[model samples]
Target: MQLNQRINAFVELGKLLKDLAENETIAQTILAKAEAENGWFTRENILFSLNNWAEALTQANLLQWMSKYNVELLPQESNEVKKVAIIMAGNIPLVGFHDFLSVLMTGNKVITKLSSNDKTLLPFIAAQLIEIEPRFKDYVAFTEGKLEHFDMVIATGSNNTARYFEYYFGKYPNIIRKNRNSVAILNGTETEAELKLLADDIFVYFGLGCRNVSKLYVPEGYNFEAFFKAMYHWKEIIHNHKYINNYDYNKAVYLMDSFPLLDNEFMLLKEDKGFSSPISVVFFEKYDSEESLKKEVSKHSENIQCIVSKIGIDNEIRFGETQFPKLWDYADGVDTVAFLLDS
Candidate 1:
């Protein structure tokens, strides 16, 4: 398919997603599909993912995102069409959709190995895309078993599984992403509105996404009351059985170890130097200076997915915006489209 044709197909897919988000009858169909496929794919989360994609796939946004790359040059660079295998992560809804889009946009065939935890949504979206542009039917396929018959691979998993991916897919051109988490830098002068927005960064997707704020960098003597108060808006999340179980378990472990914790009866905060925090918990550390904080963040750069702050650090996402990444905001600071076109 031609570049504009592919872009139009996705733009249509985006419109369909918007329709599904607004039209209750259509939304329920997708919700039922997601819920039956994975218990954690609640209706709210599925719709959130759909709505975000709908916003992202507009004609204008697609055009703007594609503007950075020379589309004509992409085909000239690699006229040999290859099949790219995508091993998706199931941490949040539609977590691997970007990779799926990247492969197709680069004029390559895609063989997806969908995560069992997120099986339904992508296939449903794929069906709609095929309906809009039948030619795409030849380009997309999903497999449940071991991946085979692909020229290259893009995989997302924990650090341990990434080692296995490296060992297995080493011969192929690949992008193997390990565990990474986002962090927020707080100067402690944030308004109530901004702090409330920061809560979205922390709690959205039930904190399952790599973009979710798993850690906080705050100046020493920063008050906890404001942060906890803002977070209280999401207090109902504790009623979620799975989340509550995590909260109860992690809290117990912290208490048993006699670790100092700031508890809001829903989430737990502990001082730590780790980037990846457990679900229902956030790690925090005191920073002495902006320069030092930047240094610390730079030290763990590879392990960080995003930095959320109003501070003008390079590539830092604004509060509540980490999860709503623009198309150019490639994961792990690695350009998937560049990889595909050049490979």
Candidate 2:
């Protein structure tokens, strides 16, 4: 298919997912199809996150961006079509979807190895596309095998798993999706609504993804009330999940036994000396000037994604837009499509 033609199909594909989200009947049917097909998604946060991804893509202006960006990124020579083996990260909802969009936008065939934890969503999405237009099956492929014989590869995983990816996939020309974390910069000028949105960014997907706001850099006189109030909704979520409940319980015990943190009732605050975000942490620090913040952020450039906050800063993507990535928002900040097509 021609570039714009394929893009138009995907735009409709995105609209289908969006309508599924807004309409109870379609969304529930797809969810049921997914459950009948993939076993694990019947679980909690995984299910919530999967459903949320469909809502996010169309709701977040990504579909609109795709319609624009896909044709713009089309390869000059059709023979140079790059076939990419995509290893998705299941930690967050549809984490690998952006990379999928990138490959497809560049007129490449994607052979995706879905995260075992996320098998349900990707397959169902593929099924929907095929149902819309079977030709998408020609553009995308699924493989349970470890990626083999591809022009390039993209893999996302934990910090330690990233090392393994580098060792295995890096030998070939590839972009290794490493253990990255996003932090928020709060200037304390945020209004109540902004704080609430920022809280959604932090708590969504249970803060498992690279873009999740695992840390925050705050101004000296920051008011914590705004954040707590916005995030209060997730309290029931925290209690209902056994793993998060364990984390909260153990975190409280550790603080009591070992030491204390600059924290309150809703969330704990701590500082780490390095880049990777703690599994369930919300670090806070006082920033005096933009120069110092820039220096610190530059130091961790390899580990950061879109900074989520209302602060007037560079690279900030605003609260509640953390996972709402668009065509050019490449993972690890590497433009894979540009690398392939330009080369």
Candidate 3:
């Protein structure tokens, strides 16, 4: 397919997703399949993911994002179509969609080894794409067994699996992403509305996504009453059995160890210096000065995916925009498109 053809097909697919989000029957159908496949994919969350993608895949956004790259400079016809195998992560709904889109948009064939936890949604979307543009049928494939006959690979996994990926696929041109988490910086001046929005950053996807804020950096003697009050808006998430179960387990561990914690009935807050927090838990640390905080964040840059703040730190994502990454907002700060195009 030509580059324009590929871009148009995705834009159409996005429009279809938006239509599905508003169509009760089709939305229910997709939601039912997702729920049956993965219990964690509640209808609300599934639709949220779908709507976000719909917003992201618009023709305008597509054009604007691609405009930054010199698409015309890319090889019009490659001597050999390289196969880029994508090992997806299932931590959140459609977490690997960006990589899949990147590979296809770059004129490479994609062999997706879908994570079992999220195997249904992407393939369904891919079917829609193929239906819209038959040429896509020749470019996309899914795998169940071991990946083979691929020229390059892009893998997303935890820190442990990343080691295995490096040991195995190290010879191939690859982007092996390891575990990373986001954090928020609070200067005690945020309004209740801003803090409320920050709740979405922390609670969305039940905090399973890398963009979810797992930790907070606050000034010394920062008050918690306002933050907790704002977080109450998402209190209904406690009704989720899985989330409550995790809350119960982690809370019990902390209690048994006599570790001090602040609880809001649904989530637990602990004072610690850690980037990766358990589900239903968030860790916070006190910073003495802005310079020290920046130094600390920079020191742990490899473990951090994004920094959410209103203090105007360099590259800090806006208060609530952590999860809504633009197409060019490459994962792990690595340009997947550039990698694929160069390969």
The order of the candidates by TM-score, greatest first, is 3, 1, 2
- What would the per-residue lDDT of candidate 2 be over residues 1-343, giving only the tens digit for each residue? 6655666666677677656655646567657755555443444544455445555445235545544334555666767677888888876546677788777767788899998767767777778877877876777899997677688888878778889888887666777766777888887677777877887777766677777788888776777777777777666554535436645775777677874565545466666555454544677667788778878887778878778755466777877788666555677778766665554
Shift in Å, residue 7, candidate 2 = 1.3
- Give the worst 10-residue stretch by lDDT in candidate 1: 70-79
TM-score of 1: 0.97
lDDT of each: 0.90, 0.69, 0.91
Per-residue C-alpha lDDT of model 3 across residues 8-28, encoded as one tens digit per residue = 999999999999877748757
lDDT of 1: 0.90
Better candidate by lDDT, 1 or 2: 1
User: How many pairs in model 1 have backbone atoms within 3 A of each other, for residues 3 or more apart or on separate chains, i.e. clashes?
Assistant: 0
The alpha-carbon lDDT assigned to residue 196 of candidate 3 equals 94
Model 3 RMSD vs true structure:
1.1
Those runs of model 1 whose alpha carbons end farther than 4 Å from true positions after fitting are 76-79
